[model samples]
Target chain A: MDTNPLDNASPGHGPVVALFVTCLADLLRPSVAFNSIKLLEQTGCRVVVPLQQTCCGQPAYNSGDYESIIPLAKQLIAALEPADYVVIPSGSCAGMICHHYPQLLDGDWRDRALQVAAKTFEITSFLSDILPIKRGHRAAIKLPSVTYHDSCAGLRELGIKEQPRQLLQELCDTELSELPQTEVCCGFGGTFCAKMPEISAKMVHDKVHSAQTTGATILAGGDLGCLLNIAGRARREGVDLEVRHITELLCGDLDGPAIGEGE
Target chain B: MEQHSDTFLENASKALGNKAQADIRDLLGLFTPLLRNAAVDNFEHFEALRHHVKRVRQHSLDNLDHYLATYEQQALKNGNRVHFANSGDDLNSIVLDICQQHNAQRIAKGKSMITEETGLNDFLQRANLDVMETDLGEYIIQQAGETPSHIVGPALHKSADEVRQLFLQKHDLGERELDNTEDIVGEARQILREHFLKAQVGIIGANALVAEDGYSMLVTNEGNGDLCANLPPVLIICTSVERILPRAEDATAMLRLLVRSATGQSQTCYTSFYSGPRREQDVDGPLETHIVLLDNRRTEILASDYREMLQCIRCGACLNHCPIYNSVGGHAYGSVYMGPMGSVLTPLLSSLEESNALPNACTSCGRCAEVCPAEIPLPDLLRDLRHQETVEKITAPRWRIGLKLHTWLARNPRLYHWLTGVGIHLLHLAGRKRGSFRKLPLAGGWTSQRDFPTPQGKTFMQQYRAQRKQS
Candidate 1:
């Protein structure tokens, strides 16, 4: 049973895509959004960046402020309603839209939320599942070997384990040294990082250590929050690792410094 | 024993600082899951069995009243007395009253988390009753006068060297260099063997109580439970009300999940079913048997939104897979129940106000739900507890206020972008040199541990708008 509605999506006709540029990607790393736009465009999609889009309300949702997330969910639904497909750069935010929106809203808003959720896809999943990039004999782009972090929400909530890996292996020429315990969270769990910093620190340190053990100079993941946490810790610990979003490498946006690196 | 769940962060900090224990926790976090995975993989029908057992548990919980009545009737017919304790105090008093009724001087106990929850050992000890733990792990923690850290392995936090020291100091049996693991076991066995024989009553916990037959099922690697049930003249099985199953097959079916999930084994060394007291043909068993079913707010949980938690088989798979539990270990949870299940169950068992920190301690990795044989949505349950905290204003006012401010800003996208754009651009300019900040005001929690990466120039929304205008 092909349960996924987006499984048969065709990109040759240039479907309209509304990019839900997550708050972290919007503020912490704008290039993730730009690169995501480029990737979507390359797949014959007319990508639209909705200006009305803000945060996905995961901070409020995760912190147990269900009252606050309702309005945010409605606003996001309204803002991104017109698109044929709503795309996101990060998995956690996409998870919020896909998994949690209906959980947080009610009645007609829930129906709208569900409609939007069905159309929403994380960038890698969007590429691989809906509008897969046509393969060619193009040479692999020059980059250091990388390891991938499976962001928790995407991997667990949406079953996004192989989509990104498959896409990265197909698109990026760099060797992907699979991270040990890649399924474990890097501990940038929204407000959890701020509230439980000591535990989060230990968790991120473990994740960074695991990535280091892979001996991959570059650590890449589909989500910006995890990359930022890993990159921040690696920099603080004086470990020479270039942390990047998969889109950055796939789109050849190497002009900017790696996460937590100087211009 | 004590509810320090409110101080979870502090305890976690202390646990992390204790490098030796934290390393053990890290190893446990790594290895326990691997072991469980191997067991699950070895079983061809693990997934099917997991679902089957989950349905059986849900059915049992759903028809709890009917099953409880049936179990009680069957148990009474089998010559066993059934007692329902409304609270921890009720259960402790009931057990004490039973011990006093027999004029029991020495009591041998098997590993019973229900007893732990009710603080039965401390209660009985306070009454000046000679109570001894029979399970090796329980005996170790009992000797140390400390609560069980891990439910399955109570003294898991203790090093073998510490156990040797404990045995040397506590065991009066003239020990000559108890160096090897076998010698230590033999010495403990030699001492516990006396207590087993002399004890007037044996107290153990049931893994499941079958309604169809009056038999209470228990599984253990140590066989101490069977010894505790049979050796003493009187036996008491202390377990939660949720442990009831419709039939013996249901009990065995659950065992298939529980054993694999707990120790990653096909079966424990011992799986015993106590029908009642000693029968006419039975050579050795307790003369009188009693089953104490502790309610302890479980009925309320069964009625509430968190009823799915009742399906938990106490496998500790959640604890093995939890990142938070991995980082801080079970003791840091500061509850009788620890790890993901503990976090969800502790608050429901106690007041959420006192244990709000337990729910908030989670990173919501959802691994617990993934590995749970009962299929409990542990992360969602934890999140709901946090929701209750918010609704009741149990969380700090500042945290609520911060959430409110962010929510309000998020609802208005333009203002959100404008405010965030200015802040991010300023941060980009400030930390553009270093590419991150070592220290920042109001971000002490984050900066204290790791650097905060600087934003990449203008916010994406701002850049997107600018690009749109240019085009």
Candidate 2:
């Protein structure tokens, strides 16, 4: 009946954020992990990426296998004890870890879910206002025209907006193209692409069409799944566009070949 | 079940779902955060309205025998006769019988997609009934002999030129060419006015049925539903079972979300709550009113795992925001409902065998969950359906074996490591400095179009183990 919907204020003693570098960031998109580090560091609070950290068991949890997720959630909560914050990168994983984990652990797990929910914040959010950053120190990075996409978890579960764009807007000469029907999902939904490849393909196709229509030379987003799907399609059509993590553009460490160059 | 065209899925897959998933990560960029911001901004609870509406529907369905009896009594009290339809045929017969009794020569309809679903017009026309559509969009699609692409915005998929061509070909115009949206709309308005005044029966779809007061809420942008219900001697409102709500206030709250999410409007141009037939003192309303609540397996849907599907108010907001519907358009869906809601609903509303392709039509990216007024978990539900589809063995046998093998290998770390190591090495050897594969075995559907980037050489487990030992 009563789960406080929003985290309107920071704790009196700034909450200690325990970083859960979701399996994707820990393994593939380590740069997301690193940039997340920079964002947490900007907060000027104790930020620790726990060594025992692993997957949020979302894949198994979403697949409707509760048994697998329970142990992992227990281990996660135990590994980061006395923690006031449990910040994570991926929206889907963070949402599952925060909302679903407690359900898996019925009795005491509800309290833990409350505990985790109280502290967990997506990277851009923590930096945007919580641990206030310098008013505006965006470095200039010359680049082709670009647009932004919001991930599902961050959009629906985490309520994240403006933080990434606030950061992106600060970077100089970044001509961000406005997406028509920008809030529509690209359909990379974790196991969804693999499960319903055909339907997933159509959604990505539509996303590419929107991007191409905007004449934005780049597609930028915080989440990897959306970018991966869109980039894959662009790679197929050989569209003259680059896809980069918002962090990579912010950090200005892009080393990959120009989109469609490899082809 | 009629099999899907399969091309839509194919084209979409080429765009979003493929082996390129692991390598790229920007697709989730815009939609995810836009919704997050919207929710944060839109958090004051309209829970009372939701509860009211839900109960209204339940109340009407429970005392359906009583409500039907009372609705009949009320309409009759207002000098209107009531007709009940147990099935589509029965409804068609009842309508036919009334039109025959009244000798209704011209029938003017105002955007009743429910009629299209029930094949009502077809039945009437087959019996030589003269039916005329009055709404600009409905009139255009009627002329073209095509079904509506969207519930609220019929003929949304059509460009002005296409509509112009249809009107020019069908409408009696000496030499004038129809140009612009206003011109087409004006042309239809001119054509339908005579039919509205002359038509004996006007059929409409109620946005909601209020149980508290025995009134029906019908809101329209052009005031077509009003004209259809008011000017005619007989008015027929055909609505699904779930449209009933407890109170008019709840309808107003639902209207707030409905109009805003659908078209960003505070309210429709014409919002009216009609109770029973017209009074003698009333300026104008139908002499006789009919409210037909069609079951059509809706009762079955309510009892199933898909009860939430009934929560849809048919605002077409999901379609308005759906990526799949935005391209190739709605005719491609081959069903009345299209987009996220359509993908879930078509199967439930119709034969699953034929409409099975609808559920599989989602990318499950979860954007549909963001803009939903009723807050339906569309992406998650779609994923659940996919799991059910696999369980039902509706998927091909080869897929079953493949998924089983993948799940098996994933469960076993030893085999998973060995297999992935070999797979990554082969991928590296194949692509090497090339950085991508134009083609790969088993999943050539992806590689044929795009390159699959070779792995970073060391697996995450290997990197993690080495780093751990060093620490």
Candidate 3:
């Protein structure tokens, strides 16, 4: 994959974007974060990774452990506060900052949360909404027919249905075959897969089936948690489809194996 | 009736494993959303109507006391007896007293989730009254001796063949072949027709209670509600107090959203508004009319953050669209109200301790809230219930301890990073060849169902820091 010429430009060329590498991306799949940085850099934005950022506090928030997540939320808000824009590679984490932060904090903290929320955008939406790289600037990525799974938080909470598709089609010039039940959950609800594994299995089973039915070799999505879940299940089910985060495919960073696949 | 929500996980697993009912649930999952979307797409002003009705529902619930009193007074003026029951048991006894006072033996009933919630039929049966469900779906489930697996389609869990067997086993219809859908309906119709004519008392649930005029609105596809309300000598309308609205137009506006969401129809076969009993000039109608309002936990719900839940109109849109509902079906919920609405309301009506798992039995997909005509935030309410669970320490100690450890680590990022770094590196080394783990210790729940993906060699932070130094 050829690195975009613009990506080599010095930092501070445009708006400063603090990349919020979500916990799953940081721990499980760093390629998502790397590709995300490349995409943002290609858009002429100065990308900064905030090391103090640990998580968006969703696991605690979703588990009803509000008391535990509040400080983490504050820590994240403080960590990403200085950036002109906070771009998350994952929609679930982005939604957490943009939507749940205001609900989680109060008073001055609430105002700060809203301020940070106003500038936070999921990676694909950030590229499409904040900095739309026209056709001339698009990277020449040759991908197989791609199908997408809309993560629940991103689809319903943030209305991220068309952003990734538009990016894939416009940027990579790839054929995007639509997955049936694209809006349905992939059964990786943070801790839900562990808490109610049976139901989660059924949901992921249905999701993998739908993806397989699409006949697309690659199933791409905005959130890594969902990708890991679908890819993990698809691997176990002996399905041949490759699961990837949309960022990885978009940036043509395919040297590493697909999710749940070894070299 | 019995709160089995505590056993939701086990119940869901059983439902998932059962091929027969799971097939039906899978079919419902596939088609119900399509039907709802088709109806919504066809209606040009579905969103506008939904918003308007949401306002109507919110306004009604906000001034619930005022509307309830106005309705009762107006109902009394129309010669209809209005009674309020503080609890489910209270409501059951009130209905029983009304039945006994009239010496009612055989009773015909329409589909009423409220009655199902109160276990009214079982209570009345204990009193030795021959009560029969008049609605085709309710009648089938009544004969099969099963609680409703769904609010709209009570016996939907049963296959057509299952229903055929149920009819043959329960009905004394000789050796008739109930092989087809039409034949099944005809058999049910023939049986229900006899009970509708013979029953001295009839009971039904109202879709909405118009407070401005003493009228109760009911929408039914089969017109069974009309038969149950008008054919008997005495009529009883069983409904919750939250069904009240300020005006007739409000009820009709809500009806527009309700019908479309519930069954994806523009209108039901019968839309009846009962304004008390028969007039002097009326030829045929119920001689006595009684309206029973049950307040199982409406007042408490109205006063809490979950007040929005009371705005629900029982459209079953949430149930139809829920993935969790699709996975396990309604019976797994172990309550009359199942699916997303039940997940929120069941805990509020009963103690959270009794139905804690019901709330957790969700992926928080927000599809329920997306399709809810009343616009109640089902996921948010479910989350609040979980919050309540944690605050009360109703959750398991091991789970809380795990959360606390994670929280403590999260607050201290250095420790979190160090620990996560070591853990990721270990996992990467262990699963380097396989790329994933078939069985992970302490993660059996996940590994049992799906493989756990291996971490890429180094943590992003570790790699990022190293790259930054090189750059």
Best by DockQ: 3
lDDT per residue for candidate 3 within B334-388, as digits (tens), equals 8889999999988888889999888888888889999999999888889888888
- Against the reference, the lDDT scores of all candidates come to 0.88, 0.65, 0.88
| Sort by DockQ, top down from the best | 3, 1, 2
- Report the error of model 3 at residue B201, Å: 0.4
lDDT of 3 at B385: 89
Q: Lowest-lDDT window of 10 residues in candidate 3 chain B?
A: B1-10
Per-candidate iRMS values, in order, are 2.4, 5.7, 1.7
Kindly indicate the candidate among 1 and 2 with the higher DockQ: 1
List, residue by residue over A187-257, the lDDT tens digit for candidate 1: 88878998999999999999888888998978888888888888989988998889999999887677889
How do all models score by TM-score? 0.97, 0.79, 0.97
How well does candidate 2 match the true structure in TM-score terms? 0.79
When only the first chain is scored, the TM-scores of the models are 0.93, 0.84, 0.94
> On a 0 to 100 scale, what is the lDDT of residue B392 in model 3?
98
With candidate 2 superimposed using the best TM-score fit, by how many Å does residue B419's alpha carbon deviate from the native? 4.5
lDDT of 3 by residue, A49-77 (tens): 87777877787788788888888899889
